[model samples]
Target: VVGAGPAGMTAAYYAALKGHAVTVFDMMEKQGGIARYGIPEYRLPKVKLDKELNSVWQLRDTEFKGGKMLGRDFSIDDLFTQGYDAVFLGLGAWRSNELRVPGEDLPGVIEAINYLRMNSEGNPVPVGKGQKVVVIGGGFTTFDCARTSRRLGADVTVVYRRSRKEMGAHYSEVDDAEHEGIRLEFFAAPVRFVEKNGRVGGVEFQRMALGEPDASGRRRPVPVEGSNFVIECDTAIPAIGQVPNLDFFEREQGVRKTKRETVITNGALMTDRPGVFAGGDVQMGARTVIECVAQGKLAAKAIDRYLAGDDMARVAEEIAEEEAVPELIDIVPYKPEEPQVRMPMLPFKERDLSFQLIENGYDKNAAEKEAARCLQCVCPDVGRCHLQRLSLEHGLTDNRFHRAEPVDYHDYEYDFSHDFILRDLNKCINCTQCVRICRDVIGANCYGLMGGGYDSIVTTPWNVSLKYTDCVSCGACAETCPTGALMMRERDLQTYELDIVRCIYCGDCVEVCPHGALGETPNFELSTYGRFGRTVLAKEELAVARTWKPSEEIPLDGHNSPRPPEIRPPGPPRWGD
Candidate 1:
């Protein structure tokens, strides 16, 4: 791994997981590349970022070497000669694109990436208090520059050549910027930077009109003749775009670059060289952190295969197959609509000359409520569906029986009344696997063939809900059904009681859960009898109780005789009656 940004770190982490000795190198003194140096602290805190990067280093056979430039410090051949089998370059686009207009080289004309990097390194540029800052372009970096300047008590104006709809920055960022007293000027292209005493004093722009759609599918900005205008300012920051700095290697290195200055790679993320690979912003240009992480994962898989002496071309084909998106069927699952959870942010009034964190994040209740809105339409047994596997094995296609009259086939209403199980009778083939398993094997006897003749179907007694039957929620019926007529609900519906005695306190469950439902109480140390003698962990018992027993007496044998009743956690209401 050549760059320690999101992509490089992710690649190193996955590569280390494969039992390979991985070494991650970055040009900066720190591990996180752009995420640490280019992005402002308000957006992503350095402490949290460092914690994640440190975990990657903790992985087996992995080490991070900072202040090491790839092409400058060591070449691909150098790595190979040093006993390394393969190399991955997750380099970033640190070079900011410039505006071609004259006077752009003035003293106060700052590059957005350079400014952000400087601020991150604690040597912020002289952009504070009573200065007018003109930010050119409309992207995430552009807004970052504008917002950072705003926080520094400077009057910031974002100048974009295109209209609002074509602006690259997210709408939320733009809205927040506007709320923080930043001005926005659209459909204006920079003509020249106005100089004042050998420094940038203002910017001259020409009015533009939206023309036909360009290759990017957005209407191009066409310059309107003689419509020149000037916006007075003390600083000029052009955040037009970013491109990778490929000066480290020449063309003979077998790693090719495009005209846009991004690295060129095959489907397997390998360069022309057999053992060299590139990914992230170095290959895809400036993109989201998630996209960079995805590419890093792909590069790790390809590098593993390369090191294992597998065919590179075959690996590329396999990667392409895995990446291919499957066509979705035309079935829409029924799901109730819920409003999105609103993020809390610092008030605009308190933002003056302050870089304090914005977007306070969701609380435990809000996060769970938001997560519960997932439709979960994708069947859990999709790839493992017995019916699907059999159909493919026999090369089956359309059902010829569907060509018969509408009365020949039955369409039954789905039964989702059960708390833990979902029943879609329309998908049932009357296989009786559920009936036999329920009656003969598990002995739940919850299902049977109901109705008569053509109307006969496999269901609970008298077509009642599974909950009303002798169903034990053993999941044997769902496991035995070949078709998707029966299935276990994928969501974690029930609130669970943590057995303090059995819990190892690894905190893995708390860390890995997407929804913030589970939380650690402050006094888990009192859970064991070793801390305080007489099994005095009253909180665990009272956690689930409907009424408190102030006068309850302990058995003193440490077992407590009877356990406390299980109670559901507060908020994000449960589904079952």
Candidate 2:
């Protein structure tokens, strides 16, 4: 693993989980690349960051080596020579983009990343109390610069060429920065820095107008003629964007990079070099922390496959198929709507001279309430479902044959009649697995493909309930079901007592037995035979078992008589064995 940022650390952590030895290297003396250095302490405390990063290091066979610059200390070839099977490049984009304007090289014009890194390390830039600072650009890093300067008692102003909606930073970040008294000037682009005695003094700007949408789908910024202005300030910081510094990657390595300086990778995140992979900012440019973490996990999976002697091309194709967005299912579960929980924030007065944390997150009660609102969309048999796996493997998503008329569609009623099994005929693909398993294996012959043409469906005879059939509650049908058309019902185990008296002799009790455990007294022992390798009725309980004549009228007091206990069923080899 290279560059121990969120992506690198995540890859190393996953690799270690696979029982592979992983060594994480970073240029910084500490781990957590930009997460630790480029983010302000108030936003993410160093202590908490260290605690989280330490978890990756604690994994078995995982090692962390800091202060190892890629090109300066060691090259990619050096790693292969060291006997490492695969190398993952999670190097983050750290070099900030240039303003390309005159006087940008002035002393007061600080790099946003550098300023944040220095401040986080306890050495803030020279923006003293009551000084004026102008922040150029609109992004999370731009806001960080403006807000951090505000904490230092500087009169800060943020200039952006785009409107608020097009800004890269979240609305909450902008709102908090405004609440902290930072000024915002939109629809303005900086032209040059105003010199003040050989140091930065102010920035000249040109008013802009939204033009035609660009490749990013945002309106391009067009300079307005005769709309130039100047914002007086003592310092200027531009946080437009960042690109990966590829100086570490030698040209002889055969690793390709885009014009933007991001490494080029295939669908599996593998670079041109067979054994090398790149992800996160280095491959996809700067992205959110969560996105970087996801890429890291994917890279780790690819690396594992590569180490296992899998063909890279086939692995790449599989990854591309897995990453394809599947057409959305129309199943909409009804859930009551609830208002979102509002985050508590520190008062603006408290933020005047301090870099205290904002957004206190959710309290325990609020957290639980928010979590309860989640409509979990995961299927119960998600990982085990063969149909789902095949759907993904074949990319069988969107159904173009969806009929427009409601009469053309068929929706079946779900059958919950069986106590131990749930039958959703709607989910049946007519695979006949349940039919064959029941007839050939269990010999119950409870299911068959019924009807003709498109209306045909696999179901019990006469489309009756499963309990009404000759099912033995063996669960072989559900086990063999590729889709969740048939499934074992989940329930808590409970003790059941069958009264020896009140002998109506209607046989209704035996008829409703979900597991088919209740039957003629002579064959009753067989139902519980393989289930837990025990008998449903103990010797003491069976001694009292007796049949009453139909003419006998039992006393009401006989209702308290002990009966057969509810036994755990469908044991080894199959349910109900």
Candidate 3:
């Protein structure tokens, strides 16, 4: 097996599990391909990654060798000659895309991927302090480049050719840049770089406007004439996009190439050459990790079929059955909850010259609370939870009614910072769908379960408010909320109300309210004329009503007097006389 990324690793695991002797080769020192180097440790920590890597390494029949570059060290023919049954090419895309501008050859211009790789590998390069750095791109790499430059003591800024909403970077990442004082210039594209002393000293940019939708269905950025501007900077980083590296396959024997320089394969993932296959980034370009894993598994099964000399159709069906599992419950159609983690940062004065890790990881209790919010998208515990089903089967209603006391309404706080996803501690059932999505799917470990026993809850680092944590507003949490606790704020506004009863002494409401409006008291009393037309008496109105009484006699000429047309009864007076 070639490569050791998610797909390659998963393929090796499954192949070994099926009692096949597998040997995997990678160019890097570690097994986790892009995941180990491309992502930051703060997001996907080394510990968690180690756990996964170890599981794969423990496969008795699988072997992994690092520092082995294909084509350069050993060709595909060499592997076949070495008595290996077959070869699977999973080499990922590593070459970074260039800006292709005039001054891009200058000393200060660097590829964003290369820069990130160097940083991730702990390699020291020239990113001088007190220098101005500009990053061009709208993807996550651009943000990473900008933020990393900031840590290196450079005044960092991001220049994107599109609007903020169109940016490919995750929202939380963009928000982190903003929160960390990283300046962003939107609707701008790099025209050229200005060089001095054979090094980049500044950059010239062209203002761009959104044009008609292109083939990709996204509005293409078109340069506006006569809108060129220049900004002086010490360095410039290009993070436009990436493509597959097919140099190994191109030079290898009996390998067919596609028009796009990708590997050509038949129905069994076998190249035109027998016993040779390719998958993952080398086959699909730079895609998501999940896609890579899926490709790896498919390639493994195809290799097995080739070795067994079985019919491809039957083999494919068996592989599909192994991959597919039946769902016990159908979940309600819900959007993912927007992430609410926000990390408070150091003061501006402190940030100007520090390289400290800005956002801390979640603590034990905070991790649990945040994990509990996960929607657990593919889990079987959605509408037909075994606990709830069993309870109903036993005719249990209000199972703990005797022990249930009135919960302090004021103790429960609400977080509505993101357009989607609401956070209310009162309604959480402690299911961990949100946590799983954030960690496994989104590739952002922003949520986790924390604390012990009854004190436990899902939260971010330091038990901070979701609006102040490192959450990226992915909506995975709100999507998994079984109860109405965590919901999209935009979908339901009436759910937020200041109840007059059951308020405890806790001040959670004051702390968790992202908007101050929730805590502000208006002078207007609950009248039947407002939007909802529901009268809610204030504390003062209730007090006044308790002391009021009706008078014994009716007024004749006052506002409460009867009209003159109404005559009083004189018979009662005559009978009394």
- Which candidate number has the best TM-score? 1
Our model 2 lands, by Cα RMSD against the true structure, at 15.2
- Please give the distance, in angstroms, between residue 59's alpha carbon in candidate 2 and its true position after superposition: 0.8
| Residue-by-residue lDDT tens digits, candidate 2, 186-238 | 99999999998989989999999999999999999999999999999998999
Question: Which scores higher on TM-score, 1 or 3?
Answer: 1
Candidate 1 lDDT over 535-561, as tens digits, reads 344555535342534366522434546
lDDT (0 to 1) per candidate: 0.80, 0.81, 0.70
Off by over 4 Å in 3: 266-268, 313-329, 333-577
Q: Rank by lDDT, descending?
A: 2, 1, 3
Comparison by TM-score, 2 against 3, better one:
2
| Residue 238 lDDT in candidate 2 | 92
